[model samples]
Target: MDASELLEVLSPEGLRLLDSLPPWRASDDVVSSVAALRRQGHPPERVSAVLTQARLRARAEAKFGEFASRMLFTEAGLEQATRLNVAARHADRYRSAGLTSVADLGCGIGGDALAFAALDLDVLAVDRDEVTAAIASYNLSPWPSSRVRQGDAETADLTDVQGVFLDPARRTSGHSATKRIADPADWSPSLEVAFGYAERLPTGVKLGPGVDRDLLPRDAECQWISVDRDVVEAGVWFGPLARAGVGRSALVISASGAAELTAPADSEDVEVGDLGEWIYEPDGAVIRARLIGDLARSIDARTISRDIAWLSSDERVETPFAQGFRVLETLPLDERTLKRELRSRGIGRLEIKKRGVDVDPATFRKRLSLQGSGSATLVLTRVAGRHTALLCERA
Candidate 1:
């Protein structure tokens, strides 16, 4: 639709007409209302558009839950994504980290903007679309100095902004799945451009959780964040470059219940090993930080290698840095013996985890007739060049 027509449809009177109806549903009532509106001569396209808009509002309302005030909503201050909580939590971190003001690049529907505003930070929320910008402004109206601007970040003025937040549009061609950063280098204004910008200020870039770590800049602080045990988004933190003595690692988790791991700063002299009496699986964030050595020391566990994420210890300790499982017995890679021994021990269902082995856990389980009564996590891994399995239980 043209801008004028779209604006007319979203005009004050139009919004009222849309809002006066009960919230949307797919049931008979909603269907009847749409049918009746059409029967009254409302164009089918307009009716369909209004229904879509109404349903979007209802969905946002549900997503914001009881904390709707913390979100940036549309003209009626409703409509939300279920991921708002995660955004809000990160916003808190931004504030606590001393970022007084922020520029939210690509502020989709303003989910993160609402969180930034909720923390009372001065925000310049920007989007390329006028409709979205208007919606953001309306959603952020409650906070002072929180304004939504329609623009592109590629050439926007950085001025004195202390931190910049970038959520590159992962989808292109009208929300179709596409490369998050078409030019991996230009991934969003190009990583080189982004790092240059970061040199001027602390920059936070949101990337897909599955992004390869090897592709990131050596100097950036990489973090993989998982909320409630489900990995959500991986981020890169870059500011002034640190001195050479400091290590390069990814943070796999947060202090407040996140799982992460780190790659070794120096890759040449690392070691690898099999599962032991105690198995420590680092958090996703920590693994990303490449700070596994720090974690290993903190937990008094030994690293199998700089690249491998698992930690081994004779003592099972409860630490957020890693998920510790008590090892029951160590066996060989022989499936027949492994299966028979597990079955004799009354093993019913098995949760298998493997590293550096080509064995398929599922096919292996079926081959051994592994279906009956017990629950356990079996580690099929190699340590010090030997294929061994460790049966474990949660510590």
Candidate 2:
């Protein structure tokens, strides 16, 4: 049986055999097998330790010196709760609000709860999984102020908490286990009810980055945060974030730098103008939060098209929220003879992009052999209902 299949069975004999094997000897066999699987086009991420106690050890190693428990490597995929980028952001919010006590509603493996406790904040870390809860307890063992408990979120008793952090279980299916809000009310009690709860104190609800913007409650101030150009989390502030009017801020964080972009709820819009020498692509969260106007004003740029998301600027603006690219050329729509023109220029590998077009990137790439050694960004989009191309280089 494959290692994962055997591990799934949790056989007594298999466990015994694995246990009897020496570490050095076992490592050789496991590494060789994993290499073969990888060569055969299988994802070797968590497959090797499927039937070994080393599975836990492997997880610990992947966590990079951080302790993690109740981490599940199920059919859906390896999901563990620990101090991730988003969790760290939430920890900052809690500290900023001067919250002394916090309730972590769906504390998976005590990642954020531990962060809260590390700050000397009294925290109740709750998880429904027994194995995960045990792991969380061990992970949070160093923190005396944090308590890890096992209970269903719907029925759990939460009281006297100065702030609440809810990252509800987004999995409802097997294997894929994609992000889904199966029951919106399970964690917050309800949309309106959750807002009411937030009105009382600082509440941070961790929603997937893909959540509909229209669903965001108007009463709660929203901040879309991106770490190192990657949109990590969108935080809602009820008590403090609201009072500060940092309403619609884009938090850009990196190892070398950090920036906070705050604008009014209805910031002035930049008028659409001709394409400039450079193009700036804003981070997803920044675009979704409609902070583009603020970014454009800061960079002295204008929109290429009101409908299109691309921003054009003549001056250089260094911000984590947007990637600036220098324009090589802009050509008119010529799909009928497009392949011939690209072939003549020795272009074979094309990275197709679309903003105001209905073309597929994969399909377009396959149809033409964009030959060239250097990297270039090709925009295959419709401007005025006609296909056009914009060859670009890094700015």
lDDT of 1 by residue, 1-395 (tens): 23443454466655665666675665637678788988877776667656656665556654465454233244322311326666775576677777888888877667787788888888888877676677677677788778888888677766756678877654441221233344556554555665566767777777777777677777765656665445667666665322233344443334374443444363232245444578888766566555666777777677654345678987778877678888888788888888888888888888888877898888887887875688888888766666778788878
> What tens-digit string does per-residue lDDT give for candidate 2 at 197-313?
575567777665666677787767777766666676667777763546566767777667767777667466788887778888887667767888888888888888766778887
Instruction: Give the least accurate 10-residue stretch of model 1, judged by summed lDDT.
Output: 73-82
C-alpha lDDT of all candidate models, in order: 0.66, 0.65
- Residue 38 lDDT in model 1? 81
Q: Candidate 2, residue 167: CA error in Å?
A: 1.2
Clashing pairs in 2: 70-132, 347-370, 347-371, 348-369, 348-370, 348-371, 349-370, 349-371
Clashes of each: 44, 8
